[model samples]
Target: MEVAQVLHMNGGMGESSYASNSLLQRKVLMLTKPIMEVAVTALFSTGATNFPASLAIADLGCSTGPNTLFAVSEIISIMIDLCKATKQEPPEFQVFLNDLPGNDFNTIFSSFLPGFQEKLRGQIKRKDGAWATLPCFFNGVPGSFYGRLFPRESLHLIHSSYSLHWLSQVPRGLEGNKGNIFMARSSPAEVLRAYYEQFQRDFLTFLECRGQELVVGGRMVLTLVGRRSDDPSSKECCYIWELLANALNEMVSEGLIEEEKLDSFNIPMYNPSPKEVQTEVQKQGSFSVDCLELSEVNWSVVDTEFNPNVASKDGGYSMAKSVRAVAEPLLVDHFGEEILDEVFKRYKAQIADGMSKEKAAFVNVNVVILLKKIA
Candidate 1:
């Protein structure tokens, strides 16, 4: 499958859109805020005396919505505060928001930019209390980050959140992974190897490409879904997919979806362990891992926080919508648009039942890493 063409969060501001269901992602960003602040502070402190006139920043996998400019806004706020503290002029900002070509860049440019600019202006003020022109420019670059997306050494800082778990394409040699849409307990050993190998290849390419784009002292803050255990089939990462597969299988049995289609389909995603990520960075040899940490967020808890009304009705409803916003486009591409409603309906029921039986929170494991280009 052409991941760039098919892999995108559901767009528009409807009820099921990513824009509405991305509170989970926003929570992840908030969780990593301290790390991001430190990374930015270090970048400036290393070159406190000689600052660039223009600062280049990129946000990879920046899907449209409220979360689109969330991190960039925080970074700019921190930078502006740092400038004030040091009595130095803040540099002109060239911010590149990146995602696949299919991403809804229109929403970002038309709906978000105006308010974002106004908010920035309000934050940046001169000594005489007049608004200072920070000269922040916004550009949307459409492409996969696994490949070259920027000119050599053009970026000063890069931030990616809740991306990178998506592989560039489905792993080759997954024929044995029948009845599974991702890494699962029932998957064969070869299936496990295939997924890991694919992650390694994609991640190394990501490192190599970003290494060429970031300046010598540039830093990167990346947060993505991950697992704590070395076992690829661990529940923290694989259980959600397994539950999803169960829902699909029920459809196949009921003649709603073809069994062959189910067998052929696999989500082009893998949640790596911290070790796996560190190993790839070491192998790539382009950047040093400054900080790597793992954290888990209970889906039920997040739902309660963000969608209390819906959560009160059915805990699975909100979580289901969140997954649908991210996975619907891919499902539509593979299964045709006909099965989406039934698929997610069954999937939601499955999640509700699974959560009840497990008695433990349904959590998404996340890995946050800080990297600096080797100078």
Candidate 2:
């Protein structure tokens, strides 16, 4: 599939929209809040008088949701607090929220932006002379973050969360793999090489682009799904796709889907290890890694009203909804919309059964990095 066109979070605030079904990603945001605070504080502490008159920040791969606003708000709040603590006049904020061209920007602008702007207006500000309403401007920049999106030396900070695992496109030379949508335990060695190589290329390009856009001392804090192990086929990274492939295989056996279609389908995603991320950053030769952390987030605990006591279909359903919101558009584009509900229903059932029988604890091992641009 043409990933950029097909791979968007479900639009509108309907039941399946990303806005409604993004509790998991929201939890991730919450978990990473402290990291953001530290990053923001460090950003301001980098020589008080060495700052620009205007601070430019971009949240890359910022999908439409409460999480998106939450991030920007957190950074703004922290920056303001830091400025006051340092007894420095706060710079005007230029914030950019970026995602794919197909993202639900209408909902973001019409529904979320107003409240965000009003909240910023309400924050008690330090008496920076002649300042009004905190002088923060928010704009939506729609495009892929893998390439250039900002002018040279325009950004002071860049942030992304729960993104970057998505490759620019599916790895090539996978047509020979039959009946697999992702890297499996049984995948050939060359398939793994193809995926790793693709990630290397794409990640290097990402750093190179950001390197040009960020000022000399600018920082970036990013959190993305990654693996703790060097092995790419570890369960932490591949189990979700394994379960999904099993669901599709069942449909193929029942003659609900053609087997060839299943074979041709592949997801454009990669979970890099911290070492892999560091390697690319170093190779790109533009940024110094300040901090790198790996944390495990349980799939079952990712909910708005998570009850640890209840391991029921409800949890399974919640997980399925979260995944569906992110993956449904691509599935619909490729398999037609008719099979969408049934497919997720089966996926939910499989998850429920797996959790009940094995007490399966699926996790996303995430890597949060803070990088500083080097001259």
Candidate 3:
């Protein structure tokens, strides 16, 4: 937990990413499939823990929403089926739904179905009551995982998505960017080196946390964006986010925004390669990759679909909607909401103008590395 010091929450890292998260559907799909296998394999793994009784689970960085529960729901669904097939008692369950403080835990917890109570009751009625009376409850632990958030060897399974790349802190030597260091990409080797070093550190801490928290042979599945290739110049493959960030910075020079605010508003994307992922896990000493999935999904121009509230006029991806989703609150944080409308107007055309069906075929980077804590 060396990252506990700098990687701890400084500000805004936990803010709402859902507003423009429409692009997450494809990544989520890719992430969910392999993990279904992991859940099933865990049930049958020779080293597997007893059914249901040993199934305490946690979704790290599970931002407050039903959306974050996609893997949670699917895994539980598979586990339930396994229980029925084995004719064995369901395992005791404890689900820790965690996130940063700025997350919406209240919204998430309040939405749990009453059937969950029935689910517990059903597991309890098992001939073996240990499966039922197990501590199958939900907890909202809000803070950086860089600090030891859970007790040692407590979790049986863990899942995280699109979250790991965020460095616990902006990299060192980014003093020029101040607290806004990770908001976008950089050209200098030091910037990229610092970013990678921070990830290695934060990732090492994450593995250390998992090492202490997971059971012998306990499992985990982590999915996040990554670079498609090692060649840095591949337009289709490398650094699409940097292009977007530059677009954002251009808007700053147009007198459309403030320099300080723009610089502080980082994109926080990570593009670790598959090899890098494998290396990071192996360095942790107790985990091994089960599967690493890279997924690519497409979008259509005629789709014209956008969430109603924040959507733009007529149709298409609303720069106002997209930018303001991050920028509005951001600018308002530094300046004031007084000019939110103006700022949106200033940059609306810039974002839309860049969206071409042939050129920028919008896509997401989903890297799912399934791991087993083999002690």
Candidate 4:
């Protein structure tokens, strides 16, 4: 499948839309907020006199929803507070929200931006009861981040949350990867090698592209799903896909899906270890890692004090909805839309059973890295 064309979070504000099901990603963002704050603060602390008059920021893979603007808002708020504390005028803000072309940019532009701007203006109102007019401009750029998306040296601060794990495309030559949809314990050595090689190429290209786009001393903070273990097929990263494959195999047995279809499909995602990511950054030679952290969040953490309405009596259902929001479009493109509900129904049951038996097994490992452009 052409991943760029097919891969997008389920759009619109429906129950199954990514906007509703993105609590996990939102939690990850909150967990990494301090790292982002530090990155932005460090950017200004390096040379306050040299701070740009118009600061440019990009949030890559910024899918539409509450989470889309969450990080951007946090970054801008940090800068505003820092400027106030340091007694410096805040720079005019230029914000870019980027994702694939198939993303629901309309929801963002029509439903969110106006309110965001109004609220931002209210926040920056002067003590004299006049508007400070911070002059923040928001633009939507649609494309894959695996390639160049901006003018050379145009960005000052870059942030991406829970997005980098997606490969540009499914790896080539995965005939040996029958019955499984992604890297799993049962996958062959060749299957593992192919996935890692594909990630290396894609990640190196990502670093190189951002290297070209970010000015010297610019900062980037990236948070993506990753595993702590060096083993590529560890359960922390691949078990979800394994459960999904089991669901598909069951359908195949029931003749709801053809065996050949299940055999041919593979998810275009990779959860790299911290070592893998550090190795690639060293190989790319464009940015210096300032901070690297590995963290974990329970898959069953559907409800929190921050969002009481998001709770689920069925943890499996909550997890299934999250996966469906992100994977349904890709699954529909490949397997036909008729099987979606049943597939997820079975997948949800599998998750519930697995979680009940082994509650500790259901955690998502995440990697958050702060980098500065040095070259």
Identify the candidate with maximal TM-score. Answer: 1
Give the lDDT of residue 312 in candidate 4.
48
TM-score of every candidate relative to the true structure? 0.97, 0.95, 0.77, 0.97
lDDT of 3 at 148: 74
**What clash count does candidate 2 reach?**
0
lDDT of 2 by residue, 1-375 (tens): 888777889889998999988876777788888888877887788753277788899999998977778888888888877877778778888899999999998899899988988777767433343346677788999888888999998898999998899999999988766777888888888888899999999899999999999888888998989998889977778888888888989999999999988898888999999999999998899999889998877877665355444444365877788889988988888788998888899998888777676544477788999998986
Candidate 1 residue lDDT tens string, 1-375: 798899999888899999888988998998999999998899899983256998899999999999999999999888888987887778889999999999999989998899999887777754224435889999999999999999998999999999999999999999999999999999999999999999999999999999999998899999989989889898888888898999999999999889999999999999999999999999999888989999888887787787788877887888888999999998999999988999999999998998889836378899999999985
lDDT of 3 by residue, 47-152 (tens): 4554434577888877634355566666765666666666755555678877666665665666543445565457546634545453456678888866677887
Looking at model 3, which ten-residue stretch has the lowest summed lDDT?
4-13
User: Scored by Cα lDDT, where does model 3 land?
Assistant: 0.58
lDDT of 4: 0.90
Summarize candidate 4's per-residue lDDT along 4-82 as a digit string, tens digits.
9999999999999999888888889999999998999999999732798999999999998888999988988898889
TM-score (C-alpha) between model 4 and the true structure: 0.97
Looking at model 1, the pairs that clash are none
Ranking by TM-score: 1, 4, 2, 3
Error of 4 at 81 (Å): 0.6
